[model samples]
Target: MAMMRNITIGQYIPGESVIHRLDPRTKIIATFLYIVLLFLVNTFSGYACSALLILLAVALSRLPIKYILRGIRPLAFIIILTLSLHFFMTEGHVIFQVGFLKVTQEGVVRGLMMVSRLVLLVVGTSILTLTTSPILLTDGIESLLKPLKGLGVPAHELAMMMTIALRFIPTLIEETEKIMKAQMARGADFESGNIFQRAKSLIPILIPLFINAFRRADDLAVAMEARGYRGGEGRTRFRVLRFTYKDVVALIFVAVFVVVVSIYF
Candidate 1:
């Protein structure tokens, strides 16, 4: 369960670097455009351009490359599974054959490309989450979705819910680790069984986890009530969000990135 403790995907690191100082709205929009660009990428040249931008962002953020990438460790199995499925399912000129299974050169190339796309997607999103605080992220999202409030979208509430969920990821992970250890101490075998048996072993853990989650939710609700909290109606923020020249520059950078990757690169 050590994997559960080191989840850094949604966790933020405090910094005063350029990337961190930029408006959260700018980061959110840029991250979305980058993800779309990743899907449009097919050639090595496109990937190279994307990678260069990522490196530049990392450098500007003053965040360690390894620290950003550590989030991928828990997802290693998923990456391998995706690559394996594409390698065997795709058909082309057979490069290797073993009885009923065949490996094709085309499959190899496609699998590698798929892996690259996945890695880029994760890294791009991680950059945004690592640099932006949850409160600022919520504010940015609510501001962007303000238009939908006319259609009864409850934008502020939705953003608040998402922010709360992100904030609780690490807490949930730590809780899961504690529960797993307690169960293991009671002679529960999680690692010495087939897939079905292993899943069955998790019943004890899930029950306590759900109970504790509900309890925590109740406590939070009580606390909010005690503080006289209400919905987002007529709420005024202490920190007003403003779009600066840096935000405009970020927008231009994304526009150029999309144009070059889609049309020329």
Candidate 2:
């Protein structure tokens, strides 16, 4: 049996909260700066400040904290692997030892920092997708990149691809859940095995999933072609984007937070 509802990163939940109403460009810039801030911070205090900021954003978004945390479940394997590698391999004052493995004070601290970075990164991104509609997100990204088009960049195409990719994440998750359930009903085992065995079991699930994904993609391309769809050149947008005082305020807040935290925190 498999469950898929917990994954919320790629799905949008329409809301009337202030955070949701902010300009998509504002949110996009904020998310990007927040990720950069994550890598810039080197102290526990910096991480704490970053966590506080994320919490503030989450509160403003009015999304359920528990619901937001549910998205972290899918990253358990990566988080665990990160913790294991850093906690056991980093050189520092040894805090504990067992058999051939040991934990160090620095390692523990570094592992916690890395985990915090990952969680913050995920929550920040999840909020962006959960609050902004896909079409709006694409518009914002294109708008931001529009200035780069003079350098031979395909701004609209890049934005469309990014938005489409984000939009497909939830679709892929649902597809995976369906495939897993269908396979399991046929007596396929995905859980009752060692790590390597479990990974091997997933091959059956992934192969069909990829095939289905490609099929859907091909159908989408044909449908677009039939509808007279072309590249980004001269494409007119139905919903035009404009900035408000709120957008300016949001951008200022993120910039100040990043700059102050990086320089003074």
Candidate 3:
């Protein structure tokens, strides 16, 4: 599907804007704080502030609005499912009624809140992945989780796995596209089926996809081992990460934003 190529949630775009220039650790921490605040928000005013923050970040990233927003498309089904549940199950003064089912004023408000929360959450995280490179993201995560290494946690290993997973998203999508084209060449009918039939048609695609994925994983492991790779013990990075003045400013902004949203918004 052409729509599959448009998915950019886990892909990084190369840019020189302030957002892309900031240290990955700063972006990661700020995103975590923003998500925390999003969960705390219960009012439209709070969501307004949140929207402003995400918009500001998007503007600074110097990325096309469409590219950033396209990441939300793949999530449309989940968003609709969540909104439907809240709209139907929440109870208040009935706004509309059909048979035994009622749409209430409270349901409408709650559904709106859930929609805003989900949108903000997805957009905020997408910004993180969009600006930061996979390598930097891994380093940032490993550094942050360095504290947990004291408790027998495999911090570096976990970070490596997470980084590989994120890095594989675009690769897997591209692979799927190739497989689809190959199947289409072989008279596979992926587009002419109903819901269940369409899903059934995907069996041919899925079989090769899973096989290719396993093959790639094995190849990656072999390559790593060939390079004398072992555990993360005493691993040295060529690019040493440091906190710059921009990182300090970003942290201050997050702190102020969190305080304002928590107490005032």
Cα RMSD, each candidate:
3.7, 4.6, 3.5
Predicted structure 3: lDDT: 0.90
Instruction: Name the lDDT value of residue 90 in candidate 1.
Output: 89
Query: What does the lDDT come to for candidate 1?
Result: 0.87
Off by over 4 Å in 1: 1-9, 165-228
For model 2 the TM-score comes to 0.76
TM-score of 1: 0.79
lDDT of each: 0.87, 0.88, 0.90
Give one digit per residue, the lDDT tens place, for model 1 in 134-221: 8898889999899999999999889879877887887899898889889999998888888999999999999999999999989988
TM-score for every candidate vs. truth? 0.79, 0.76, 0.80
Screening candidate 2 with a backbone cut-off below 3 angstroms (N, C-alpha, C), the clashing residue pairs are none
For model 2, what is the alpha-carbon lDDT of residue 89? 98
Tens-digit lDDT track of model 3 for 1-265: 6888776655889999999999999999999999999988789999999999999999989999997888899889988998888878987899888898888889989998999999999999999999998889889989999999999888999988987897898899998889988999999998786899999999998999999999999999999999988979988889788999999998899879977897876
Best of the candidates, TM-score: 3
Candidate 3: 10-residue stretch with minimal lDDT: 1-10
lDDT leader: 3
